[model samples]
Target: MTQQLLLDILPGALPTLETFVAGVNHAAVDAVRTLTPGHALYLWGGQGSGRSHLLRARAQDPDGHYLDARTPAHWLQSLATDEDRVLTLVAVDDVGELSDAAQAALFALFNRWRAAASTPDAFALLTAGDRAPLTMPLREDLRTRLGWDLVYRIEQLSDDDRAQALHDRALQRGLKLPDDVLHWILTHYDRDMGRLTTLIDTLDQYSLAQHRPVTLPLLKALLTRQHPDPASHHADAGRTSP
Candidate 1:
């Protein structure tokens, strides 16, 4: 089965606990996967570190609700007022980017949730940020609230991890992406997993469309068409500059 074929069987790529490549974030992954109501989980990591992925996975459950920290405060407050709502999980992404009003609202909601911590079906809060909770620029009280639960730092994946991930993903698609090809990709493009995965998917599609196996030459052709050399752009600009 080709990668495109595998993708065609599904609606689109959906991040789930089963699909996550937990390099050093195993603790965070496990907590999000098994967290019960009334508990809270805070995850912090750099871009492409799988913070959003895990948060989304937790939110995939029937009783889970996902929100961005940047979501308007008035809207988040509305969720807090629903005393009869069955909110087993609430995952908030990018907690560090929350606006002032949103921070205030989250602070209030956190206090309310804490008060009901003893309830059997209490709502749980999960959040992610680029930095640890204490280091975030949020309100002091909210920062404290963010750390009131289990906290884990999602570690960034090393180059070796990314290579292994690419290999693993390719194997799953019944494709044997060569070591040289994978190495070429890593050396030439952004090492961020999210972008790399997208590139892999595009390569798969392009290879299928062209009836060609994935190879270094094919990758070079594809990338060249997509991104002209920056040096060329600079030369053109220099020629036209006043």
Candidate 2:
């Protein structure tokens, strides 16, 4: 199936530029929004630093495409070369995890994209990784291609940013999350935005099921139920990275 179709069927949060808390990554976010065709932007940062969120937001564009480690680079070429294709946005996440075969395919595709850089049909490429392009464990040539245009290190969100994000999320769900409740989660649970958001979604469902408003009590009950042992709770939170 096409990447667009796969994205349509996948059930998950739909990240957008509006939802992303720029924190210290405003430049990175702006670059995504004003991306020029044929240019590639490489973003690197710790887990939950909004790399994937930015990619997904750009992918939401009608002319945008999102790919990950699971997608073979050959498939990328086919999509890029589709007869009726126009200027497209290609967002590749977790470049460091691509397999050897995929790496070779990406290398070839990169050259093609670069060769067409000055053309009207040039494709915009964006990629994210755990580390900078040069530091990634990939072929030297591929690494160069990954960083050919621009590179940015995504800054991890500050504590205040996390709190605000949590607040915004609660409001989106029509829940008035108390300041105390927000404080409790940020203080006790993992701070990773991805995991924290998932937790909030779970709480939303649990609140609906139990016919109770979102409160500290409801959150506590769900967390305790989800992780019976206190030790296991902390362990699980620590294990949840971006």
Candidate 3:
């Protein structure tokens, strides 16, 4: 799908590193600047740490080329030609998930691109769950070289940061959520920012479906129905039993 369509389906606002309210704010902008000069960067962080978000923002640049490692080897091999030179900003998400042969191929591509006489007008950004690529069950050389460039540890968001993020997201979606409802969702629902944003979208849809305003009662009912507690339902059923 085109990037615009993807954005429409997932309309969560893009988080800016410059004024990012959460996570390791320091490392994000630094990573961007380092990559702008055509250096390979390894960003390490767990899920919900904003690593993928930052990578997506960087890939939005016209010269960027986002190559999902899950893609077929033939696709990547096709990108090796000089015609793809304009694909300067390369993002490889889930590098650890690549196959052994694909890993080797990626390493070779890096070596070839790095050794070019000119900079080749390209930069690479790699993301993985492991801090060092060596821990990802790859060859010794590829693992070692993955850490040759800058590596940043993306920190998780603090509680306050997360609360603000929810509010900001609601505002971006043109939903005027009350502070109490935002807090209730943050306190009761999952802590992952990505999931929280999705819940907000779901609630938005639910509100539209029911033709009702977004209120705490409505949110609670929706959440309870979507994520029903079996024990509580059984208890209520027993109480009403003849």
TM-score of each: 0.82, 0.79, 0.72
Q: Best TM-score goes to which candidate?
A: 1
Per-model CA lDDT versus the true structure: 0.72, 0.73, 0.60
Which residue segments of model 2 deviate by more than 4 Å? 1-12, 77-87, 172-174, 223-242
lDDT tens readout by residue for model 3, 99-214: 87667666766675566425655556444444556676677887777777777777888888888787877787788788788888766666556657766777787788889999
Name the TM-score of candidate 1.
0.82
Residue 5, model 2: lDDT of 10
lDDT of 1 by residue, 154-232 (tens): 9998888889988888877777697789998777676456556656777777788889999988877666554333432
The sequence of per-residue lDDT tens digits that candidate 2 reaches over residues 1-242 is 00011111123466678867888888989998888787889999987677887887887776777777767666666654553666477787888999887777667667767878898778888888999888999999999888888899999989998998888888898877888888988887765576677677677777889999888887777765542333332101110011
Best by lDDT: 2
Tell me how far the alpha carbon of residue 213 in candidate 3 is from the true structure, in angstroms, after superposition.
2.1
* Model 3 residue 193 lDDT score: 63
Which pairs clash in the backbone of model 3?
none
lDDT winner between 1 and 2, please give it. Answer: 2
Give candidate 3 misplaced runs (Cα > 4 Å).
Answer: 1-21, 81-85, 172-180, 187-190, 205-209, 220-242
Q: Candidates 2 and 3: which is better by TM-score?
A: 2
For candidate 1, the per-residue lDDT at 187 reads 78
Report the Cα RMSD per candidate: 9.1, 7.3, 10.8
